[model samples]
Target: MFAVAADDCAPSDPTLTVQAYTVNPQTERVKMYWQKANGEAWGTLHALLADINSQGQVQMAMNGGIYDESYAPLGLYIENGQQKVALNLASGEGNFFIRPGGVFYVAGDKVGIVRLDAFKTSKEIQFAVQSGPLLMENGVINPRIHPNVASRKIRNGVGINKHDQRRCLLIHTGYDEERRVFAEPAGDKFL
Candidate 1:
């Protein structure tokens, strides 16, 4: 819910942005924070009171939207000039390993998504996250997704405006099929 940006940050800068979300399991409340890299303070963004089940666990949290089990990213993760988890090329389990799962990255003044194979050889990535079944690729919805599929779940994805690298988009599709959700631009919205 919170987003941070440096006063005069650019993509080439290592400390461009940071976003954090704290989820309280006991209270089922989620708080978001955003701050610029090296900033003195974090700004509160959103405090969401999530619905909990009888067991005191969030009933319908968005899975795969944030951290995965063990608090590790479900796909490739890169930060602070280091690759946290190598690009996953093998088809294993989960949506993350879906064939052709792609990487969303920021480098210099550019924001883009490329197939994992291509990302492995790239030398300019500054930050990145890998996610599967790309909702869209090269300006088109992935052919793998069909409109009539019976199975539907809350889903989220990132997109960058090809015309302007600085303008990025975060899309969250809730369980309801009739409504569309779009988020405003944030420093690390793609992440």
Candidate 2:
């Protein structure tokens, strides 16, 4: 996964930040990178193939998934024991306010997705981000999201197996223009 950010300077300005993570869940290995905007090339931050273990699990993780016009998180965002952005309670427009939008959170060794209301009362949350009308809930696709929605857009989300807490799923959907259909779900493991 990759993330890039730039300051509000002119196009010719050289103030940017880029981060990339290469994760191999099957081998439990991770690689990271950092690059500045001065035309400097990417630099490895964690050159070693880091293992994901109880004693050395990832210290922090961010969605870097989606955002809004103002570049603010379009959904819920929590970091370092603080709610950086409150659970969105307003309604009307946008994908985030769709009924049943959920929040993904990590607390201790546990990771979960819960409805926004449930999140308000949740305890011990270490990191969190809210996004979307759930893509799936209780093993079923969210009723509000239809396969033939007006627009076909790329989407991504996180899910956890109800019977296996250790197994988390990251899903990304893209359209195969040639086939005129969404591509098969790409699944990735978390930690």
Best by the lDDT measure? 2
Q: In model 2, how many backbone clashes occur? A: 0
Steric clash pairs (candidate 2): none
Model 2 stretches with alpha carbons more than 4 Å out: 1-66, 121-123, 175-191
Model 1 poorest 10 in a row by lDDT: 43-52
Per-model lDDT: 0.46, 0.47
lDDT of 2 by residue, 116-177 (tens): 77776355766677776766555555567655555445544556755566434444334422
**Clashing residue pairs found in predicted model 1:** none
Write candidate 1's Cα lDDT for 1-191 as tens digits. Answer: 21213232122223422222222222332212222344322221122222113343332222222345345555676654467666666667655655557776666555566777777635666567777766555555555555555445556555665655454544445464311222223323332
Q: What is the C-alpha RMSD of each candidate to the true structure, in Å?
A: 12.7, 11.9
lDDT of 1: 0.46
State residue 90's C-alpha deviation in candidate 2, in Å: 0.9
Best by TM-score: 2
Name the lDDT value of residue 102 in candidate 2.
81
